[model samples]
Target: MKRRNLLIAVILLGAAVIFYRAFGTPDQLATGAAMVNVTVPELSETANEGEAAFNRLCASCHGRNAAGQDGVAPPLIHKIYEPGHHGDASFLLAARNGVRAHHWPFGNMPPVEGITDPEIAEIVVYVRELQRANGIY
Candidate 1:
């Protein structure tokens, strides 16, 4: 019984240390955004086209301003622009393949099939613009 108890304690201690390393301290969470690195290009006509596409397809669930719909989608402004938000690569992957909760909280963003690669690129530009406008940049 003594040996078993010691083993359990050791395991628990190891798990706690691992969790702390992975999650870091509360201070890390508060100031983490400052450590993020993103390279955002200036909005171009491509971004405008993306905005139009969003209005036609994503507006219903994501909202005209990308503020996110209650019980449907999440706001795209603050979360995406904040330095700690996500790297552009993650955003690109999520948009192209439809991510789960890494980006939005509406479950899965089904792969926007019917659209061309250029269109998807445009949409990404528009989303980035929205993020910037919302103070994410």
Candidate 2:
């Protein structure tokens, strides 16, 4: 009887593993945890203005320093977002028009309202500088 129960337990465990592997994020993102450790560098005057704008507009979801909030958003400092792949234009477009979820499990990002074109541009600069500081470039 004990052997039979053990075998059943093993089967259940295997099924759980498969389910998680198929639909789960293997990192801390699900809990809204910070996904990466970021090192901030001194910013240019534009970047500094961008940082303030980011804090006001983007920080609620993107997290402080753009480290990313698990289950909320992906870090801009990640390699997938390096300028070559995502580019400056992508960021600009995303702020103006919401972006669909393509590279991440965080779902779609809606268009950010009440922010101007110039502020969004500055935010991009801040994000790029942060990415550079973190060795993502």
Clashes of each: 1, 1
Candidate 2, 2-109: lDDT as tens digits: 999999999999999998866776653277777899899999999999999999999889899998998789888899999999899998899899999999878899
TM-score to native of every candidate shown: 0.56, 0.79
Q: Across residues 26-137, which tens digit of lDDT does each residue of candidate 1 receive?
A: 7544321222232344667888788788777666666665666654665555555454656666555755687776553346776655655666667767877767755576
Give each model's whole-structure lDDT: 0.64, 0.90
lDDT of 1 at 9: 100
Q: What are the runs in model 1 whose C-alpha is more than 4 Å off?
A: 1-44, 80-84, 102-105
